[model samples]
Structures are given as structure tokens and as C-alpha cells.
Target chain A: MLQVHQVSHSYGGSGWRKSKAAAGKVLDNVSFDLEPGCCLGLLGTSGAGKSTLGKIVLGLQKPASGQVTFEGFELYTKGRQGIRKVRRDLQAVFQDCYSAVNPLMTADHIIGEPLRNYERLSPAELKRRTGELLEQVGLAAEDGSKRPSQFSGGQLQRVNIARAIALKPKLIVLDEPISSLDMVHQTLILDLLSELKDSIGLSYLFITHDIQAVMTICDRVAVMDKGQIVYHTDSPSSLPSAEHEAVQRLVSAVLPQHPSLRTSWV
Target chain B: MTSTHTLEVRGLQVRVNDGGKSLPLLKAIDLTIEKGQVLGLVGESGSGKSITCSAILQLLNRRGLEVEGSVRLNGRQLTKLPNREIRMIRGREIGTIMQNPMNAFTPVYTVGSQFVETLRTHSKLSKMQARAQAAASLAEVGLSEPARVMKSYPHQLSGGMLQRVMIAISMCLQPALVIADEPTTALDSVNQLQVLRQLDKLRTEYGTSILLVSHDLGVIARMADTVAVMKAGEIVEHADVHDLFDRPQHDYTRMLLQARLRGRKDA
Candidate 1:
């Protein structure tokens, strides 16, 4: 459903001060493909350009080079209206849920905003759809009346998810959606994502530094290092050769076992 | 050296007043850390890990917060000390690295200026001396060019580099104890490892005791000598790192470990 070829992006431009001159490239010749109904997990450190890639795919940022196509249609060539329509088909769950939704708006308004924009629905239908969306995401109907601040981080994230899927987008870019959450809440969010994907037959572009999270949610995984895809594997069992020094270090860093591993050390 | 127990906590409790009623944030708790040892405090949000640390540092506001029990650092009672004495000990005797490095630093000033200011506040060092020490500390924390970094603003550096700068600033004081509250939570995996490795090195070289607070079990396993599992403002289990991992008696600890392991296996 998605294809990106030889994309590159840098932060600064010419005529800047000497110290800021030629700011290093954030993404270098990045390429990837995502099939329909499959999750493509992007794993990278903070500066590894994971978010940058997500932004490019979402058409939020213009890539310095390379082209992005969605089902053979040029994403950038279509301009604003086409891009907006495409965006309605491609949703995103951002990292910070608290800021993702407007604080002044109630959950009903927040979740209903996308539906209102993308589809023409009467007031009664809008309210009904908002309630249903909230319920779908495991939230109560009463929650739609409350503001963003009244909920916890996990709950806010659920609201964000509800809004993202309100339009029933074909693809969802989950950008470190569970990073700020605690263990139990993290699991809950992951489970919710899985359930939503299955029920809606939606594809996911999961971006996170969390190797474990990627392993759990992704059908395929790609490890990005220094703005390049260092390894790509079809499944957890098919992880790139551990003999590769970088991959070996990453594997070791993940800490595969628990209590027994701890006890054995003692 | 002093006794093995560099810091001791006994029945520590914290309560915050909300709507004219006291809402207990931390239940009675006990903990101890030996010199050069790393202790991990693990919990979900609102579990009171951060509250406990804030209580120890006397950073909690008295207007809405109440603290009970005893906290001793190097045989001195932290709770009993007056604010002046506590202020004297804060940055000089006990350093802290908070979760967000960007929030911790000032955007208006260069990193060097902030570092010198921090040094001058606790010591009688001149600007040049403080600058030199700050550069040295930055270099020690793995900054490629400390001199250049010193002149750069906080926004000029990446999140990982900013975090490293925070670590440098905290350790430059040469405190006996360091309280790192999710120090690498905002960092990516590589930067996270870099920060943790640097912290490990700090403990080794300076014999500085560390209290590492995080929700990630993998992080706790790699860095902690002792592990304390916290839930809803209380310590559910406390033991040596190996024991806590190998034979977690508490169900919550086991669950956390299981979740962490399941995550690893899935990866």
C-alpha cells in the first residue's frame, strides 16, 4: 500500500551562520515498502530518523529527495487537497497524546472532529458515531463529555486512537504510542492496537525505539541506524544474522530473559 | 570509606493536600544503598517513585505536601536538617538527573554559562575555573569537543547530547549520591545505552551511589545492584538485583518481569 524510494532529508539550509552551516542529514537514502494489512515496524534510536520518516510518509514534511507513492499514486504531486484526502486515508497516533487533542474540546468534539471534517454527518449522527468510537476503543460513553485533562496518559492515548480510527483510515502510523506509559498501561495500549488492526483490517506503521514492542506488534521489522536500514527481517524468528556486530549488540541490549537471568547472576 | 549503607530510608511517607484533605502519595517505605551501588526503583505512573525522591531532596512544597519518617545520607538525617543545610547539601552532596534534559536546561544561556553558574552556586570558584571544570566534566561524559559544546545553546544539540550534558552537569559536582529519575526515558535506544554506560562508568570511577528510577525492567536489570518494586506508593518487593529477577516473591514483580520477558521474546 505504501512505497518510499531513496528519500533524504536535512534540517538547515544555505546562507545560515558558519556554526550552523551544512547541518547534517537526518535521513539518508531511506527506502521501504509496506504491503496492505501488514505492520511494518521501524526501530531506531532518537536521532536515527524514525519520526522523520513517519513525517515524510504522512506528507507532513517534504523530503529533500526521493518519491513516495500510495497504490501507484504520487503523494506529493497531488498538492494540498489531494494530500488532505490522502491524509484522511492515512491516520496517525502521535507520541504525546496530551497535546495531540485540543484541551479545550471535550472528548466528543475531539473524536468527532475528524468525522465531521471527512464526512458530512448530522448532529445526532455525529454524537452517535462519537459514542460508538469511544466504546470501540474501550472507553465509556460518559467519557465523551470530559475534557482531555480529566483522563490519564493511557486514556488520553485511547482517545487519540479513537480519533485516528474515526475515519477508518487504511493505514495508521503509531509513533511511539506507548513510550510514556507504564508497563500495564503499555500492554493495554498494545493490545488495543492489535485488536483494532484485526477488527478493521488496518495496516500499521509502528515506529519506536523499543525493540520488544516492535517484536510483539510487527509482522516485519526494519532496524534503522544512522538514517539507514541496517537490517530487515520478515519475522521475529528471521532476525538478521546476529554475527553482524551492530545487530549483535542490539540483541544483547534487549535482555531476552528475566527472573532466572537475574537469579543466575547472584 | 563510610559504612556500606550510604543512604538509608525508614518508614518514609509523603502526603499531599488536595481540596483541604490529605491524599497519601507514598506509603511507609524503607530502602538502603551502599556506596558505589546502583539501586533501581521500578513502578507504573502514580506509584510514588518520584514523590519519594522529591521528599528525600526536600523539594516537595510544604504548603500542600507532608513528609514523615527518616532519610539519612552519609549518617546525616536528611529530614531533620534545616532548609539552609539541606540547600547546602542538595547540588553539592546529592546530584539529580531528571527525565527531560531540555526542561532541566535554560534556553537563553549557553551550556557553559549554566554549568559555571551551577558550580559557583555550591563552590567559591571563578568563572574561568568553573568553565574549565565544566568543559572537563562534559568531556568526561563522552562529549566529543567539550570546548565547543560549552558555547552551544541547549537547542543547538540533539536530545542525546543534551542528556549527556545534564549528566555532566550533575556529576561535575562530585556528589556522594545521584538520583536519576528516568534519565534516559526521553532518549532513543543507542543514546539510552550511552547514558546508562556513562552512568555505570561514573559509579565505577567515583564510587558514587546511584538511585535509578525507571519503569523499564530491561533497564533495571542492566544497571541496578538492588531492585525495589513499587506499586501505588508502596514497596511490594525489595531484594538484590539477582534475587529480584531470579526469584521474585511479589506477584507484581513477577508480572513486570514476565511482561518484560514477553516483550523481549516477541522482539
Candidate 2:
């Protein structure tokens, strides 16, 4: 489980300020929780500070105020030890697969790097596990032998997901993981993520500006606006009931229903 | 609206030289945009949505790509027109809004100057008259300081600002049909909403027809009256927006509509 408590961050001075410490705040007193095996969709428009929260949660950046804890370790407080613990428990899947991983590296090497660095494994075992991870993410076993460029955008995203889960972290922070993907692939990726969360017991802090996305994949949804959590719902079905103008706008913008819904969902 | 039909394409085809071999990129695509209507062209990458737009705008032929078939704008034959005559109509008759507004602009020229130049090309308007109209249009799109926007270079503005200006410029000429190729793709959700709303306003108030191409179904749903689903260089389905969403005839359309990566809720 992960907890973000009273975190706030900012940059840029009002005028001729001596330091960024005196700069304007971008994130203001934001807080949320990621329950075990739960996918929490963090929804917000651009510049709403959702990404800032992600960085803080990942221990990549220290917020000017508040703290993020993974399991029992205070990610920002445990210092190097806390950071290392978070690394062992937390992983991330980025939006753009083309830039997320090294293009020249074969999918095998890309997924194997985390295994090689985190655990002591023989080349044979590493190679075997890479193939398994690729397959687990719904890619062909042999596909791991090809470089990132040799794969389509959706396929490369699968590679990225494979790399994220190679270490079997407790939680994965997916930052618009399928934004660049086409519709069909987006459905496949979402289905894969849901299956993974159920089978592997992985928690997802899914961040995106999309409303329909949260309604489909997330157990709970948090809507942010202007650096604050404007609305939070336990069931995504309740999102339309939210009174915030931002949430209303997002809900209203959800696309018309599709024929696929006849067999699947509302 | 006497003319319900604004733009029509019949059996439009395109082929590109792939390593010295001519490969078909678009397979006789056909669609129409009615006056005051928005036609949504939905497809995954390499589905020939962009190629369709290029075929209409004549960007394909200029790049040495081969095109065939017919595109008509209010009975004007766009495909067979001479290059000079087609050039005159491409912008003045069928305006285009590209995905990236920043790259669409001239880096050195002020946006105001560009607007004036574009307006002058389409109509017999003096510099002062064009400037006034451009500023007014900018303000109409909720952009403040129209004068400053005109004076500022494209780089000086944000994506949202540049997009608003782009919309302003495209609408200023009051072109019959606007071909917007992923116009809101580069923008944030808030900006995307603003742009879509402004476009919707144009169709209602000015009766401008728009060819809206995007991978975002939410956008297409909101802005489009009709929808065309393209896959692998072919149209899989075409229907009214309501019909397409309610009863998509093709598997590809259903897949795209459901491809938002959502999961079933436990509750």
C-alpha cells in the first residue's frame, strides 16, 4: 500500500526572489491513498499537478511540504534507505514507449536490466525470465529478441509494461501508459493491466486526464484541479455525481457508448 | 442551408513509392461533409486518415505521392483543377487546421502579419482592414489582448494560445469547408475542450463544415455529426454519429470505440 500525506510543491519566484524556496506553489496540500490491489485513477487536466504528485510519490522529487510512504518506509524521510526500499516496491510505466526505454536495446535486454541489477541471476535465468515477462504482458516470447524500433507503438508499450513488472514490484505508477496507443491497442493494454492487477495483486496509481479511462479500469478515482484534489470517489460510477465543474466537464465529455459495451460494460 | 452537401469525395485513392514500388495508401475512400456539419474520421495510425486529408488538400501530389479519384467542393472539381487554380481554392475555399499549430506558423513573422497576409490572399482587404478583422476574430475566441497576439511571434504564445490564434485565422476567411487534422491532439484536455467548443460554435453560427480527424473518440463524438471509420487504408464503416455509436456495423469501429483502456468495476 502507498500513502501520500499533505504534500505540496512549487517553483518560480513572485518577483526578484532569492531562491526557489520562495517560489510560487504548483501543488498545494494534496493527499491520496493507494490501497493494496486497487487501481486509483488520478484524473486532472494539464497543469493540474497530477504529474507532480506522481514524481513525489516515486521519490524522484522532494515536495516542499508533506511526505509519501511506501509500505512502512517514509519515502522522503528514510533517505537513501527509504529511496531504495521504495525502488524495490515501486515501479513506473511511462506514456511514450519510444522514449521510455533505450531504442537500441532488444526487449530482452530492456526487461533483463532490472532483473540483472536487482537480483543475482545467471544469463540463462535472466533470458528465460525476460521471455516469460514478455509473454505475461501478452507479447510473443520471440518478440523479446527484437529491438524497440522493430515493434509497433502498442507492442513497445507492452515491452515497457514487461520491464516494469520484471521485478514484481508491489505497486506501479502508470503515467498515461496508453495515451500514445491506438484505440484497439488501448483496449488490449487496459485489459492486460486489469488482468495483471487481479492475478499478480499489483496496485496501480493510474494517472491520466481521461474520464472514460478511469470509469473502465480504476476502482477509485481522484479528480484534481489547480493543484488540489477537487473530487474523490470510491466508485467510478459515482464520478458523474461530483459537483465540481471540472469533474462535470470531464464526465460530460465521456464519449457515446460503443457496441463492445453490449457484452462488456455500461 | 440550401446546399446540404459542402464537400464530397468519391473513390479517392492514394499511393506512395515505397522503396521504388508503388503501394496503395488509400483504397478508394469516399465520404461527405454537409454544410454546418462535422465529419469525424476515426482510425488508428497508418489507417489513411491523414492521407485522406492530404488527398483533399493536394498535399499528397506536392510531395510526389500519386493520387487518384475525385474531390469536389460545392461542385468545384478539386482533383482535376490546374495546380494554380487548386492552390487558389485549397486555402481560400477549403481551410486546413493541422495538429501542431506552432509548426504551422512562420517562425520569423508576427502572427498578426501572417493573419493579414492570409486574409489578403483570400479577399481584397487592405492591411488595416485585415488587422482589425483578425484582432476581432482572436477576441471572439476568448483570447485577450488581440493586438498583442497579432504582434507576438508563434513561439511567444502557449499551445492553447497558438491554437486559439490558429482557429481565429482559419475562421477569419470564413472558408466553406475546414479540414482540421487532429487539431486538438497536441493540446491538453482543457484546451482541447475549448478548441472543440469553439469549432462547434463555428458550425452552428457560420454554417462552416469541418472534417475532424483524430484518434480520440471522445472528441469525435462531441464535435461530429457523422463518423467514418478507417482501417488499413479502407473505410470499414460510415454512419451518422448516433448510429455509429449505438450500432457500429464493423468490428473495427466497435473495437476503437471500446479501446479506451477501461476495466469493469467490481461493484
Candidate 3:
């Protein structure tokens, strides 16, 4: 499990000294918990500090204040070994599937990179595990030989998901993973995320601007606006009724006035 | 103004030749936008939606693209027009708002100067008049203190602001048609709604027909009077928004609708 506690971060100030000019706070006392097999959704539009928070949680950037604990061990406070251990458990898949993977690397190699870093697997075993990862994501085994450009955007994202789950990580930060995809493909990716979580008991920190995507996949939703969580709800259906003006704006923007698709053919 | 049909297309086809063989990118296509109506074109990437828009604007000609068919703007055949004449109609008569706000703007110049230049290209407006028009256009998009925005460079503005500016400038000329190719796709939800609202306002006030090309079904459902679903470079189905969503005729259209509305509106 992952727990982020009162993490605050800022960027862009005049000097390095403590009494220096005030900086723009990208994250202000943000906190969240990811249960072992549940999904926690963070919904924020542009400039809402979601990405900044993602970086802080990933240990790519240290928050100015507060802390992140993975499996009850302080994340950033720990030294090299602790960082490495946490890295193995915390995975991420970003929006740009094309850039998320190296164009030069083959599909299986891309997935195997994480395995190679985190585990001590022989060449043959690594190859087999890579193939299994591809299959788990509903891709063909032959796809392992193909390059990133050879595969479509959706396939590349599948490969990224394969890479994320390569080590069987405890938590995967899905950062707008399907935003670049087409609608049908978006559905497929969301389906895969749900399947992966339920089947393998994987935890997800779902980060997206899209309300529809969150509703389809996340168990609990947290609405972040201007670097703070304005609304948190376990019931996504109740989102439209939230009192906060920010939440209301997002809800109106998300919910359609009429039914878009019919459940039954009637 | 007497013509109910603002723009028309008939049997539009695009073919690209790589090496010796020609590949059909867009099959014979037909669509129309009536006066003050929003015609939403929805499709996946490479569904030739953007290509269709380019074909309307006659932009594919630059890529040595072989385009076959008739594209008429208010009864004037655009495909057969000479480059010089078509250039005249490109922006002023048939305005465009593409996805990327940054690419649409010139980096070196202030936004006001760019607006003035764009306005003067098709119209014989004086510099002073163009300046006033540019500021007015900005304000029309709900940007307060339009003068400050005009003076600022494109980089100074946020993506949402720049996109609004794009919407503003597109409508400044009061063109008969506006082909917005994913105009709000790059912006966030708040800005997306704002842009959508602005486009709706344009239909009410200016009566400018819009060819809205977006992958978002939600956007199409909200903005469009008619919706055309495209796949593999062909229009699989075209119908009124209600019919398109309620009773999709094509299998692909049905699947797309199902994909977006797969689960409960919220889990």
C-alpha cells in the first residue's frame, strides 16, 4: 500500500535561502492512500498540480514538505536501497505511449527493461516472462519482435502497461494513459486496467482530466483544483451533487444532459 | 444569405502516392453544413476526418495530394478554382481553427499584429480598423481586457486562452463556414466547456455554419445538429444527433457509442 501524507511542493523562487522570495506552490498539503487492490482517481484539469503530485509520489522530485510512505517505509527519506525497493513496487504509465517507450527497443525488451533492473532473471526466463506480460495485456506473442513505431498507439500503451506490471508492482500510477487513444481503444485500455486490478490485485493511482475515464475504472475519486483536493467521494454518481463550485463545474463539464448509449437494444 | 446550404461537398476523394503505388487515404465522400448548423465529424485518428477538413479548405493541394471531387462553397466550386482565387477564400470565406493553438500562431509577432495581418489578408481593412476588430474579437470570446491580450505574445497566454483567441479570430471575419478541426481537444475540461459555449454562441449570433471535427462523442452530442461517423476514411453513418446516438445505423457507430457509454455514467 502507498500513503502520501501532507506533501507540499513549490517551484520558481529568487534564491536558495529559506528567507528568499515566495515561490508558486504546485502542491499544498496533498494526502491520499491506495488500498492494496483498489483504485484511487485524481481528477484535475491543466495547471491543477496533478502531474506535480505524481512526480513527488514517484520520488522523481522531492516535495518541499511532508512525506510518502510505501509499505510503511518512508520513501524519500530512505537512502539508495530503499529508493530502489520502492521503485520496484511503484510503476507508472504516462499519456504519450510513443515517447513513454523507446522507439529503438523491441516490444518485449521494453517490458523486460524493468524486470532486468529489479530482478535477477536469466535471458530465457526474462523472454518467457515478457511474452506472458504481452499475452496478459491481450497482445500477440509475435508483437515482442516489433518496434514501437510498428505497433499502433493502443498497442504501444499495452506494452507500457506490460512494462508497468513486469515486476508485479504493488501500485501503478496511470497518468492519463488513455487520453491519447481513440474512443474504442480508450475503452479497451480501461477494460484492461480494470481486469489487471481485479485479476492480479494491482493497486492503481488513476490520474486523469477525464471524468468518464475515472468513472469507468476508479473506486474512489478525488477532485484536485489549484493544487488542493477540493472534493473526495467514494460514490462517483454523487459527484454532480457536490457542494464545491469547482466540483460542480467539473461535473457539469462531464455529465451529459441525455443518455448517450442504451443499455438494452429496446 | 439566401442560400440555406452554407457549404457543400460531393464525391471528395484523396489519394497519396508513396513511391509508385497510390494509396487511397479518403474515399469518395459527401457532406454539407446548413446555415447556422453545427455538423460534427467524429472518427478515430487516421479516420481521414482532418483530411476531409483539409480537402474542404483545399489545403491538400500543397502536399501534391490528388483530390478528386467537387467542393462547393455557397454554389461556388472550390476544387476547380485557381490557386490565387482559392487563396482568397481559404481564411476569409471558409475559416479554420486547428487543434494546436501554438502552431496556429506566429511565434515572433504579438497576437494583435498577427490578428491584424490575418484580418487584412482577405479584407481591405485599414490598420487602425483591423486593430479595433482584433480587440473586439478577443472580447467576443469572453476574454476581458482584450487590449492586454492583443499586446501579449502567443506564448504569454495559456493553452485555453490561446484556443479562445483562435476561436475569436476565426469568427472575426464573419465567414460563412468555420471548419474547427478538434478546436477544444487540446484544452482541459473547464476550457473545453468554455470553448463549446462560445461556439454555440456563434451559431445563435453570427449564424456561421461549423464543420466540427473531433474524436469526442460528448462534444459532438452537445454541439452538433447533425453527426457523421467516419472510419477507415469513409463516412459509416450520418444522421441527426438524436438518431445518431439513439439509433445508430452503422455497426461502427454503435460500437463507438457503446464504448463511450459502456458503464454507468458514473461508477
Instruction: Kindly list the per-residue Cα lDDT of model 1 for residues B1-267, writing each as its tens digit.
Output: 344578989899888888888988999999999899999999878788999889889888877778899888988888877889999998898999899989988899998898899899999999899898999889898999998999999988987898888778777788889999998888767678778888887798888999999988877878898899899999999999888877889888888877765655555
The DockQ-derived docking category for candidate 3 is acceptable
Query: What lDDT would candidate 2 get against the real structure?
Result: 0.83
In model 3 chain B, where is the ten-residue run with the lowest total lDDT?
B258-267
Q: What share of the reference contacts is kept in model 2?
A: 0.38
Q: After superposition, which runs of candidate 2 have C-alpha atoms over 4 Å from their true positions?
A: A13-23, A77-79, A258-266, B1-5, B19-21, B61-64, B80-85, B106-114, B120-127, B144-158, B257-267
* DockQ for all candidate structures vs. native: 0.45, 0.29, 0.41
> lDDT tens digits, residues B25-112, model 2?
9999888888898999998888899989888887775466778888888877777778889878877888888888999999999999
Q: lDDT of each structure? A: 0.85, 0.83, 0.85
TM-score of chain A of each: 0.92, 0.91, 0.91
Q: Write the per-residue lDDT of candidate 1 for residues A150-212, one digit (tens) a residue.
A: 999999999999999999998999999998887778888998999999999999999998777
Residue lDDT tens for model 3, A1-266: 78899998887655565565454788989998878898889998888999888877777888889988888778787564556667888889999899888899999899999889878999999999999999999999889999998988998999999999998888898888988777789888988989899888898888888887777788899999989988999977667677998887776676353435312211
TM-score of candidate 2 versus the correct structure, residues matched by position? 0.87
After superposition on all C-alphas, the RMSD of every candidate to the true structure, in Å, is 2.8, 4.5, 3.8
Model 2 chain A is weakest, by summed lDDT over 10 consecutive residues, at A257-266
- lDDT tens readout by residue for model 2, A1-266: 78898999986665555453543677999888888999999998877888888888888988998978889888876446788866867889988789999888889999998898899998889889998998899888899789988998999999999988988899999999877776678778888999999988999999998676788889999998889998888999788788889898776655444433222111
